[model samples]
Target: AERVWYPLWDAGLKLGHQVGTVAQLLDVGAENLETATSLLAARVVAASSADGEALVDDLAERALAQWKGRSRQNLDQLQGAVAERHARFGEVAFLLEPDIKEARGGLRDVHSLFWVEQATVPILREAESAGLAAAFEMLLEVRVELHRLTGQRADKLLLELQDDVAAALGLADADVLMAEVSAAGRTIAWTGEGAARRTLRASRRRGPMKALSGIRRREVAPGLVLDDGRLELTDDADLGDPLLVLRYAASAARHDAYLQRGSLERLADHAEPLPVPWPAEARGLFVDLLAAGPAAIPVIEDLDQVGLFVLLVPEWEPCRSRPQRNAYHRFTVDRHLMEAAAEASRLVGQVERPDLLLVGALFHDIGKGYPGDHTVVGVDLLTTIAARMGYEGDDVDLLVAMVEHHLLLPDVATRRDLDDNGTIRQVADAVGGTVLLGLLGALTEADSIATGPSAWSNWKAGLVRELVERTSHVLGGGDVGDVVGGSFPDAAQQALLDDGTFVVRGEGLELTVVAADRPGTFAKVAGVLALNGADVLGASAHSEHGRALSVFRVGSVLGGEPDWARIDEQVNRALAGRLAVAARLGDRSRTYRPIHLTARPARPTMTVDNVSSATATVLEVTCPDGVGVLYRITRAFAELDLDIVRAHVQTLGSDVIDAFYVRDQFGAKITDPEHLAEVELSVLRWVAVDF
Candidate 1:
């Protein structure tokens, strides 16, 4: 029904004893010619067969055995050998070793093929001839396709390898597996040496007979074998031209790629450069990029999203790096700075939305370009360049803000000592608002990782905690209570209970608040009740029919208020002049009719309704008004196979929202919103949350 095969090739030495009978017949001059030919062929087949077999007397004769045993013990380094030359060949045909270490049972034989294909897909391709590689423009095409396949993981080496055939063709760590196929369909000995030689031949693509078809020789390297064993071209013109330079560089990259894996010291004497901002023009373009702002980004050329990244790093101190004291530092301040930036990008790649955030982390310290007043000098320079390049508005704003706030992480980390509030205030000040702490937090996490673990400690987590608190407060959660409270007039418009209104004339924070009246009239204020002990917000009023009423709404004021104390005093004086003002110096209160907002739960039971199912690591989350963070608790249950029976999410602002839900998997209504909140808070701390 089924067949098996084995192979053994030992460079034509100590041949199996079957050949012994053939040799004797030849020596005695009594060979039967045709008979001898058949006999020799049978011997070779038997040698490769997995085991010796005998004709069975009965169908169920389990007593018969076909045995084969290992005669030598040099197969220990087999996998390393195969992986080392993975880039050289494809469709490797080899017998399985008696034992497989990493996988279990059939996993070794079946699963390995799939795994090998996957790992090498990013770094290697089906390359038999350079002609095919060139015809497909395999490097560029593969990269685009690979990036699509990887989706969000595009920055990782795995994703980058999809387009890296030029380099992947050279990664010796991967290989295609091949199995010896024959007509006999019987067992055979393993030919480990044959596999190795075939690997070398496949790596070269074509033998001497077909070398000209694809891998033609052309000398490109200087001081190396010119017009000798390897490929080469004599004209210096190929070196100077941009298009030609890219081609040759790609060629070199691929060539070195192979040589590097073979453990060859250096593949070439020159560097392979991608098409990008000319190193010679870097100074002016850097300045231009700083200026062009957001518009400049849309017009970027030569550089892809991955390569456009640049990092700004600190000057190295001799005493600071204890490990590298012995080696002379070839990377000076400028070069080391570049390295730091690169390191930072590598770290940021692992975070969510890293593409957007890493750009700021890279360019944040670029303001050091000027001799003095980096903030002003850099800002001015950036705006000028951006204006020149047709960049303005939000693009310019984003860049300027990042560069301006770049020092926040290091400044806090290296500070003498900073309390939680101080750290939070600093973060809020840099980001323009506490609500943006999530974005800033992502940036901070990337920066810390970019610099490596030695750069931070548990003490640094306190800084993150402060920022989270402020951010959560801004997100309509946490115990922010009222950052800047304002006054509401007593009696809703002759008790009409219809107009939702609030009066906050302090600190430019005018908002329209509306919510049904409940038990906690004072405590349930959603946002900005008081800040720095002053009501820096406006008044709000809301009312429905007499049966259901609450207060929430704020006066809309542009550019916000300035100096709550000054505004409060001015308001008091104006109120005293206008009406009977009983406003005391300290105690203040407001009563207003209330309005209600209906709550609806999200439902996706039918297949048509539930199309997308995303499996993501929970990063950051929130809950609806008067509701705690049910999202986090449900997500935790999801992790533990706890199904959410019902869930609802309500968006209140651009970066803020809240969710509520029931998880039947736990079989109980989560009553303690505070406990849920605490769980969310602890989870936020345990993981530097992202989304």
Candidate 2:
């Protein structure tokens, strides 16, 4: 009874609508089992015919409800049935009726089908040329035969009706809408001229139609994309349909079977195309399949096709001339690619997807089997598989492009002599552009990791590091410098003690001393200060962080003629730029420990001039200066091998300084006054200056 209402509804709702576009709204049911089921198709009942404003508003309300599985006019299979109805009955008028599909599987809910059955009449209809009215009636009779005789009506009848529609248009069925219907569980083909093409006598499953095969999975590499075969695919390998079951079965079967040239030639001649009945004009491949075919490429899709043709044409298995000494290589060329693919699959952080990476890695080295660049060959393999897999055209191209630059990580990044970013960026730019540099970085790491521990070394790993860093810089841009700067901390300020040692400002600077740490190390250091008249405040010595660090914080004593300023300045200048010492000067500085400089009568006395101007003064006198005594005294002092601590001598208009500090027999300072006097008298007796 509901079947009585569909044509009426179609005529009422969309008879005058444009044929090229879907009406204002259409919804398909969401179901795991069936292909799209529920639907709501409508054109706006416009108040004033104002375009999408009215149309979209009408569609949105219904569509939102339909998407959420709440459309009142939803249909489980409206398109298939209505499409068939149109073909059988020609253009029938439809009326606005309650959605019968929402109630039952078929037009069986007759109680809800309370709508008038209206005949379709076009206001500006073209003339019926090839007995359109009679042909349509005949088509409906055939549909009834399938429903009554076979218990089902299928789309094949619609294909037959297409001929009649085209006949009305003065043409044979142009195959524009070829229909195949499954009736009584058998596929039937109908032509446009109200005729059947060929009865698919076998069930649709028995013919070339595919069985419901679940997608197959296989091991691939970290960054290399793999075909379902786990082979690292070349760019050409990114076939739209990787599972090209026929190709894979053939490819896999070849591995297990004996495929000689004679056999291959025979196989090529009979090799079937895509097992699925796809659109004839759909972007596809028809490989020569024969090794000796003159054509390298049967069909090309984007830049990736270059890669596919190469993999297809080559003999990929390796020979016996293997690298005997290498420990990691366990298989021939082809097997290695698969193994690398497996290794690459486990990696993350480097690629967008490990599976994609695995595919790429497998192809990266596969081309090495050929005569020229392996990258080129690998890319070709990728695109071929892409096409075979039925990937979108752009997707196929992207897959191949990845393969073309897979080897660049090693070939360009690592510099034996000098390293730079240009090569890294160039490789990355070629790869998934700047976006996938991180993935390339992961691929680079995987390449090294695949080489195994023994074979991969500092330089090799460094190449990986360079690629990682370059990618980071490119991706991070301005933020990379912040990463570098965060590693080292700023130097803490230190105080400059008058005792030529730096005192750390906040805490003592962890002194690192790499010099000879000897027995007199502490003593000798203390002695030098004592001799220089610097009183030590605090000192600590330790070894740490690959160097010996020593710190001494002391202040200048009243040493060297009580000239504190000169002493401190000289000490600072002496310590400044000393090889073993360095620190930042700050508010926390070292002060000299207090010590006195007392005048004592001795042979020679060392005095520090505190003032800016140079001045000389006598510190010790041997005996009294008498007539000619001064000359004798001076000569006596000179003869005694004594240096006048502050005697300024004018020699040929040049000032010669006779500076002194009295050193004993052991070259020590004469601090004792009595011993100093004895040493002074001895000097006087030697030159007859005084007693």
TM-score for each prediction? Answer: 0.26, 0.27
After superposition, which runs of candidate 2 have C-alpha atoms over 4 Å from their true positions?
1-330, 348-350, 353-355, 380-385, 388-394, 410-435, 457-466, 476-480, 483-691
Q: Any runs in candidate 1 off by more than 4 Å, and if so which?
A: 1-356, 367-391, 413-423, 434-439, 458-462, 465-469, 475-691
Report the number of the highest-lDDT candidate: 2
lDDT (tens digit, per residue) of candidate 1 on 1-691: 0122122233222233322332453432222322222222232233323333232122112211110011011122234534443333211111121111121111122222222222222223222123223322322333344445554323122212322432344432211100111100001101222233333444345346445434444444442222212223343333433333223223333343111111111112122442333343433334333232222321121111112221111211111111110012222122223333444444443434333343445444444434576566556655554443344476567656655655565444333112223333434455765323444555565445444343444535554555455544645444333331222234443243455433333323432223333222212222123211232111222223322232222223343443455444444343234421222211222222111121121221101111111211112233222211222233344343322321222222111132222222234443355644554554343222221
Best by TM-score: 2
Error at 36, model 2, angstroms: 69
**Deviation in Å, model 1, residue 225 alpha carbon:** 24
- Residue-level lDDT for 599 in candidate 1: 18
What is every candidate's alpha-carbon RMSD to the true fold? 23.7, 35.8
How big is the positional error of residue 197 in model 2, measured in Å on the Cα after superposition?
A: 50
lDDT tens string, model 2, 506-607? 122122122232222333332233334443333333322222223443333453232334333433343342312111111111232212111111232223
Model 1, 646: alpha-carbon shift in Å? 46
lDDT of 1 at 339: 36
Counting clashing residue pairs in each candidate, in order, gives 77, 96
Q: Give me candidate 1's TM-score against the actual structure.
A: 0.26
lDDT of 2 at 92: 13
